[model samples]
Target: MLQGVAVWAQTDPGPQRIARFEAVEGSIQFQSAADNQTRLADPRWPLAAGDRVWAAAGSRGELNAGGAIVRVGDGADITFTALDERNAQIRLTAGTLGVVLRDIPPGDRFEIDTPNLAVVLDRPGRWRLDVDPQRNTTRVTAEQGSGTLYGEGGQPLAFNAPQSREYAFRSLAGSQPLALNSGDAFDRWSNERDRALAQSPSLRYASADIPGVAQLDAYGDWGNDPRYGAIWYPRSVAADWAPYRNGHWEFIPPWGWTWVDDAPWGFAPFHYGRWEQAGNRWGWIPGPPQRRQPYAPALPFGGARPNIPQGVPPGFRPPMQHPMAPQRIGAPIEPLADQVRRDQWERTQRAQQDQHQADMQRQQQMREAQQRFQPSYGQRQLDEQRRQIEQQQQQQMFQQRHQQEQLMRQDQQQQMQRMAEQQARQRQIQQDQMQRQPMQPAMQPQMPQRMQPQAQPQVQPQAAPQAPMMRQGGVQNRGGGEPGGRGSHGGPPPNH
Candidate 1:
């Protein structure tokens, strides 16, 4: 009992962190980090240290913080002892929880303490913890990777896919191993879920390193916009769907209003980038994933908050059912800083905002310069177009001249034939008149005038006609139109 107090005293809480509520189902209630009151659980609820979540009968809950996913089964209670970037500590008082640590950096910690012993996962793996305080026993089954069960005397029993008994910490001098767990329906379900997420086409376009991208793939499909690069649209949402809707506003200590979304895949999109209206729908612009994310949505706009169930009432505190039980059942239980201080999240946030504003200014300047350059571009296009029209007119003139010359030649030929026919007829008539009657007035006969025609000039059409390139926005070049690509994710919330 004195040990708890000593550990709590020596510990220095550095900063606050957020764990993701990946999924929530059935009857479950969790205490909020912002308001310290037990409220109903939602998929996108952000949990932190000092929070506790209880799962009622036939209930299930899942918390995903970075690479670790801790799932609570029915009739279970878990407390967050230390939930931060470097360590993730939880105490399972009763019931069972399935844990899957996808990745854990070296020197990082993930521990699940039970009444009998403390289970520490030193590597990436899947494990299950079941505690029975009535029997004063705990059992840890390592399904994959490696872990260790530390006794009260500081003895470590290595686990490489083994099932082990949870003995009383100081009493058990030796530890034994058992068979590797074959997994259950939940394990199969997880495998299928991951496989589906891996195959998501959005994964290819987006940075796989982004934590909440898999959720995006599940909720939306990838599409490309001519103005923006690759984007994604939610499958089922209001036509005027906007981010920060269907959520509540809770005041994060030292930080202003923080939005908690109810959707399962809400964290990354809200914390990292900006939102652009891509026609009828909205798309999140994650920017370059190779940078730090902010605390609030990178870009905040004023919008109405969604109507949601109110948090736990004021002055509401859970009953203390078991006073002797530890929040975490582990050796040398480390304490978390309960005091609120300057938040590091908001610090990064301000820096990111400054950078974002600078970038916007630069972009505006570029756009202004482009606009100034457009007049000359349009002038050049107009000159080239006029030249094309003049050439076409010249070609038409030459073709018309040639056609007229050809028609004149044909008319002259027809006239000459008619003249010859008339002359022949006249000669024949004169002979007939002389034969029929006495010859008279021979002096009057004179030579007929010779027919003549005028000459004309011929012309040829222009051989080649060229057209210049006509661009709408001057020399601006854009991404090539491609059909398939994984969409990018992340962005700030819309107006409240």
Candidate 2:
């Protein structure tokens, strides 16, 4: 059953979940693969593979793909190129993108490409990619962990922390070093968003691992329900609002026919669990955290399979623009300058979260016994582990380019091994089939000059014909190889 209502990406594979985007400012429109129609992109729309996302001159877009998050700059045209279990690649046709990664599992890759250069990230890092279509150049700034920039001719350039590089659209034109770019309007804005998410009033209400909880802070308020734990009520939705009414249905592999909600705070509530209506209001119930994450939940769609356009899972369709009255849905959310209590808030929830983590881990263990790694512990453990890993990396970080190549080699080797195993199995099957088949007569090679063909048998042996039945005695003569076989129906064996 399609369980998750608003799963972010497609396929059951890890890291393939779509990236949820919330329009922070200006005019951003998304173009789906099936219908070239462009609609004003809304917040909480998950950008899956083959989807093209663009921001108008002054508009900005923020996307969150599970643990990885990015902010798209103005006048930028970016496409979701490829996304799967171990890798994600986005292509920038114009403008800039800011990325911040909290963790990157080994054997996994994150990449961004422009006309002339390709940037690949294998470690936890924060960086920015800028494409100058008019100038035929690209710029990169590494804010945190190191990554590599590869030129068109496959030349590689290293980008250590606090490093910047520029490249012209030339044949193997090497990257030029530039001063670190840390402060700018975009940077400030990005920082502000982090701070907002960090201090969101909803932190106490939802799971910390919930991807887009940060954006919900300024958009909605939490209400206590007698029936469904903590429920978030959006400020703009009408009193009669219900889930799935405004979203379109599209199929994502593994989990088919996912619902893409238009609400900015739609991700967490829709993907995690169920929604219930009480009195004149509707509330989201984020079910208990499970070991496995869903791409989207099973939304009740009146037993109908919504239209699926693309031939693939990581495909997209234009935003379904249902006639919506602005006031009837939601109004602008004004930021509230409430007292920031992140420290105290976390302190109070520490014990609760620890217990929750233990429960989640146990549940995950049951659901995915074959999983090698699980986020069963609290954030502290993960942070400490990441810190130690980073320290070790800093010591050996200069060899990043070589490491990239080595990882690539390892992936290729694994692929080759899989192919060889498949070929071997095929060959074994063919051999087994040949062995089971009946052998045909072998033609005698042209006998030596004087040899002659052997004569064929004149007659073949046959079973002796049975005697006619002696119906008068109610008996019939039957032949048998063994002696003393029953001569007829065996009526006291006519004393012979």
Candidate 3:
């Protein structure tokens, strides 16, 4: 063992070896230049110019010139052709690698050119390049500092600002820039973080600390702590589906059972769509979050969000602002109550109007049916019914007219009787007034002096023409003259 620590090397179609090796803190392994021999180490090793390396489980190493680090993960192969105190250039034979620099030396720039993309790192920052051999697409992420990416003809793409992401060299010959996602961020961070952890090697925490451990510690887990970024939840099946190792997770539509991982396109759904429960199964639909979906009385048909059991809490839901949160089922939707009430009222009114229209339509249909059948064998029965209905209508009209006429006659007779009785009462009041006094005193004011003149001839004016003789019973007595008691013919008649 070298330095009392186990050291191993294999050169079977792998990177060439370098002589005069030095190990640093069991973290960084370094070797001096050896002519025509390739030297490689685990991701924990450091590399320099003129060194060729191959990554078995995606190893990332550093270059001493300005402490710049480059990582290659999972079946990747890279070679440094011009690495030195001033020059940094590498070639990627296959797979993905990310480049980050501790400091960029003045007049010392690094260039990475692939079949589809070319990146020139002029500043200190983190950047990634992914080459899909079959698809021929190059994905890039520039986390900090700015860089210029080029197409085949050095056509410039402005890749400035931190976290500015893009994908180049697509399957199609002429393609637009593609944006980066959280999953890509996760992958990039994961790789670099892993490289850092491998370099240092002694840190631990708990499951809660797993996220923190991944955040804080650069070294890998020493005590096999679950909290060291070494866990993944199944998302579909909660029954402990953590990857004891590293892999990928893919979303399949219709039945969103996340059944596949460890592939190029598998991680896209979680990064670009929504998760929902449909048909009692989980699924992912592609869209933005629906912040105003109505609260459905029942879940939507087909792929719908199934209710989680009380005992099982689903994974934490992402905020609406986050782009990757699923839209259909997991979308953060909240409809206003007024909007809901308005919709319900509109539906109710529509139903009511429809029912009324239907009743009218049914009546029309029945009439049409009767008319249509009248020309057939059922004509006799229909005619009989129609005749009976006509007769009943005629009878009802006649009764109404008769009642109106009777009411009019009774009202006229009562009016006549009232007029006669009123006239009789007026005549009786006049008779009573006449019997009380006569107007003779007003006609003779000098009569009182004549009566007092004693011895004077007792002359009296004739009594007022007897008022029209009062009639008795049904007839009036004829002969009733004044003072002489004689009728105009000079003969007295019966005076009852």
Candidate 4:
């Protein structure tokens, strides 16, 4: 059945069971005003009440309440509001959300809102959406089947096919379909880190393992968790890293730590300044970790005054020939100050330039989007429609030629009659041509005088003996009348 585009709204109000929420795989650690739960959210996590969930990349948290499973890529945040069983709303504040439907009961609806756009899923199928808050753009890919997109004004944008993607500008009212790629999925996953922390606010934490430190005595017990695989410092440590008191630690699964290991953020740079993990234990490899102090003493300047030469006068100096000259202290002061000022100025300029570049890039993207998304009455779509039409025409032409050949073969009686008539006509033409040629002189002229007188004219050859015309019904004689054989019917005689 063809899918149509239409917009509809939820008629109910207040928090209700619009759909069921579950964590099919990975873990969905939730921390809200009323509840705090962190467990293996496999199979499904039913949302008894409104709660915000953080999903790990490549991991999925299904919100059956909206009939959609928002697959959190690398770092993503998704909030669900079950206004009622009849209608619910989902906001993919950041990252990517993959929504698939098992079976959508009638009157049940799912709506997803992003910073750039919103999608209302009233029909079934698999679809993925990516939200970029930095650039304020939303990208959606219809993986299988299709879905409908509801813009700000509540107009439906229909997308179909196995892997089709579309881009929606945040400030605009419509979207432009884009060529889809798998990498878009990963980009959505990677971009969710900051936004996830903002909504749930618990995912962000500080690292306690600084280099050259024996133990986190000041910030006690800072190490990797054997279960969740991320480095975590207790709230009791420094108050600086603590964002919330008594909140669930939702792990932001980084691409480190082997399948069964329990050390989040991997065993790389996130932990100690210089260390490598070998086997089950972490190893320390040191060099530059200890050398970057702010101040150090040069050898000759060590705490002693130099001895003066015996002849030197009390108020005289060694003509400034000393390795550590007195006047050198203030020399080039202006040049040094100038260098520092230049560095500061350059840094400021660079920052301003960078901001300008970013703005230009954004504007260029918006311009390109506007050009591509101009209101179309679906006229440019005719190229694909035309291709389909031409294909059909070619198929029809081939079928017609095939049918004509079949009909000719089926009429065997007419074929035989046509062949016989053609052959008879050919024979008559040949007979006429033969009759047009005069009979060749039977006797050649004999030499006269010198040789015996020409022999008496050879008996005039009787008109070359007429050949019998063989017909199916009767045999008839055909007398030759021309140099070439001719039939008595005034036509060429048959060769036979």
Candidate 5:
């Protein structure tokens, strides 16, 4: 993962890296840092410190912490104790987890705390940890890298690749290290997922270090522009689809209002890149590659506002504008703030117009009532209007119900027609089989009587009757047989 020193202006605590739910399956539940109530997990929501995730039975969850991938298996529980550019700490309470570390920068820490021991990953590799609460044991298996295990007493036990050990809760006193056992179904699943991520074609255009970039390959196409370089265009979007429109806003701490997109490939493009409108299609520009790209909560229209970090050297200009200013091509780009103001003004005007019309109607009704000196007349008019409205509503409801019934009848007719056709085809197949059965015996060659022994005298008697049957069978076969025949042999049984 790329490590950056730039901090978001809205976030006060420093430059905090945000992790996201890359993949979610079945009943995955999560609790945010600021809330205790658990909710069904959404892949669009970012993961941060103090957040808890639970993969219920028959469920699986995957998280991308920077470049490292953490997969949670069924019945697993985990919490993000700390997550930022410099450190990623996870706490596992029960079940299984698989971690694939792509890179670990210097001075940065990646640790997993189990019930019994703290497993620190010091190198880039794959590791699996399983916790059995009933046994009060935590098993750590280093599939490819080395790490140190710390017990409750702070005793350190160094383990290298291809090693596994089960330690008692809070103690490593007499634990024996063993060879790593063969992985089970969870391990195979994790390996397949890792391979897919590694082979993503979007990685060539977007950085692999950016979480959720792998998901783009299936949902979009990557293209290049002379001006903006590589760009990604999403497939099967609405004609009016725009960035930040299909998603909702949530006030997440540190980042303030954040965008949670409904698309599976929405995270990386919305948070790390800028959008450009070309003709009627929108393309995402991931900007130039940086060793450590900064994370943005939302990239609003007309390019993202500069998120100037604190403690910068002199003369530092943030990359706020896209490669081409006025991000839209072939059209004028409107600033988001100005657009919001215009929409608000239009709404206010509409409201005022509606209110003025209502007042005019009220005054007209009052004047008629006063002129006639019959206040009950106004009430009668109101009642008549209400009755008209009720009649119209009832008419519309009747029309809708009639339409639904027509549709149901049409569907039933089509289904009956299909069944009739299918049955006809089945009968044709059975008739064809019956027609072919009698021809098989007649097609066989008739041997001379001298070729049979004298003990087969019954065959001769049966042969006389078969001769007539063969002639009848041949006549039938001739009707369906080929045009030409071998010496009147009934066209070789119709070349079946």
Candidate 6:
């Protein structure tokens, strides 16, 4: 392990914590402490003290310093005045910034200095600071945190959540109460980003103390290893891909020859862990969670040398010899120049052959894994197709049932209508028959018959008296009254 350790000539104590550009939107640039020239910012680029970041108009940038998340709005300029184990200081020159101090280490200090005041974070919470150079004012909004603002020759003004205050740059005699306005697009974007990072799945595997761990959830997956405990493997990498291959090196002062990866999820793994080959895939082992790991400039392996840029600053003195140089036993006979050249050529050939073999092996392993997964993938596709067919069949059956029910209802309605019409037609027929029938004459009541004359035998011989009889059918009847007998006029007699 000692032989593999990289040696560096340090001018100052190494920073236990460093900030990296976690995200960038639109035009953003930075000036490094070692190189004063401004360059386009890369998300993987590590930030140190004396470095300045600028977000041009219509641009934004975000930085992750340990667990603290810092976001700069459009047209903002900020400088990392100090960043180390126990202190993080930022100088805001213009525009707005949103800082979320999720967890401040014990005895650690986080401060933001503006033209008007120096805002020192006192607790872990959300904070927003705005520097208006035109108005010569600094505004502090403690959206969900507490901090103290120190001004020139004035009392330290302490502000807490749900508070906003504005102070003049020249004097801090008093601060005017300002309304908390988080409705702006910048604040909304910052808050949304913070919420997403807070819920990253990578948090469960890696320690939050590691900067850029939040990005791992998007570009990689975490797995449990029996030997390495928790390890992370990057997704969508080529079979021949290896750590520190897709990045360039820049001599960042204090820590020379830093690696800047092109990958988005490249910071924390390269800076804080050891890479191991488990099977054919490379995984990052974040060491033991119990231990505090210092930031490393690069974790190169396989006798890799730093690609130092030209025109290095005079202050940075590279090592006199390669750190990996072997020890010599006494003073051996020096080799001829031709012999040295021949030995160098042989070593280069061996290294190239070794690299080629490793790449071929990795490719073979990937092909095998793909072969093993193909059947399962095909099975999943068949299962999905079956499910879709079943769903379609069920849906068609339901539609058919619905249509049948509707037709049955229509049939029942038609049957009922027919029955009603038939009944109505029968009623009409009965009414017409009743109107066609003939009428009969009313009957008159019969009168009682007169009593028959009591046997008048002797007096009838003297004279035949005329007796009036009822007229029947326009004929008069003259005869002796008899009971229930026919009259002389041939009409039926009435009842006696």
In terms of lDDT, the best-performing candidate is 6
> Which runs of model 1 end up more than 4 angstroms from their true locations?
1-16, 162-164, 168-179, 182-212, 223-230, 235-248, 252-255, 260-267, 276-281, 287-496
**Candidate 3, 343-430: lDDT as tens digits:** 5787799999999999999999999998877676587789889999999999999999999999999999999999998689659855
Tens-digit lDDT track of model 6 for 1-496: 1112233345343455678787788898999886687889876667788889989898888888776888999789999999877899999999998898977767989999998889899899988888899999998898887888788875587777988888897566667888898588897788788788769888777776677888888798899877557888899999867665676656666666666677877788877765656667777777665444568775423222323444544665432222322332111111123224555887899999999999999999999998877767688899999999999999999999999999999999999999998678658755753453233235634543333442111111113343433333322333444322243322243322
Q: What is the TM-score of each candidate against the true structure?
A: 0.50, 0.49, 0.31, 0.30, 0.57, 0.57
Better of 1 and 3 by lDDT: 1
The TM-score that candidate 1 achieves is 0.50
lDDT of 2 by residue, 1-496 (tens): 1221123333342233566664468888887654555667755445566778888887777887655777898788988887655677889989889888766777878899899788888688888888899999888888899887787678786667887877788544555688777577778888887776678676566643355666677787778776545667677877656666666555543344555666757676656544555456666554433222334433221111233333434454322322322221111111011101433465579978999999999998887865555555686598888999999998687689779999999999999999998678658755853554344356633322222242111111123233232222222232322223233222221111
What lDDT does each candidate get? 0.59, 0.61, 0.42, 0.43, 0.69, 0.71
Please provide, for model 5 over 1-496, each residue's C-alpha lDDT reduced to its tens digit, 9 standing for 90 to 100. Answer: 1111112234243234667778777888888777576778777777788889889887887888885888999789999998877898999999988899888889989999988999899999889898999999998888888888899888898878887888887988877886675567787778788788878898777666677788888899988877567888999988766565565655566555556677878888877666765456778777654443446665533433323334333443322333432323312222233334556887799999999999999999999988888558789899999999999999999999999999999999999999998678658755863554344366666433233221111111222233212222122222322322222322222223
Candidate 1 local lDDT, 100-180, one digit each (tens): 887777778989887777878988887887777777666677767898777777768776675545554344454455444
Clashes in model 5: which pairs?
A: none
Which digits, one per residue and each the tens of the lDDT, describe model 4 over residues 1-496? 1111111111121222322332245555553323454544422223433566676666554443333334555456777664444565777877777765534567877677887667776567666777777777787776556556666666666656565544555434445557765765454543352244234311122221111122222233334444223332423423322111112222222111101112222221222222223233332221122221110000011012222223433333221111322322212111122334655887799999999999999999999999988756676577768889999999999999999998888798788999999789769956864665454455744323222232111111244554434333222333443222222233323232
Could you tally the backbone clashes for each prediction?
8, 15, 17, 34, 0, 0
Sorting all predicted structures by lDDT, with the top scorer first, yields 6, 5, 2, 1, 4, 3
Cα displacement (angstroms), candidate 2, residue 218, comes to: 4.8
User: Could you give me the TM-score of model 3 versus the true structure?
Assistant: 0.31
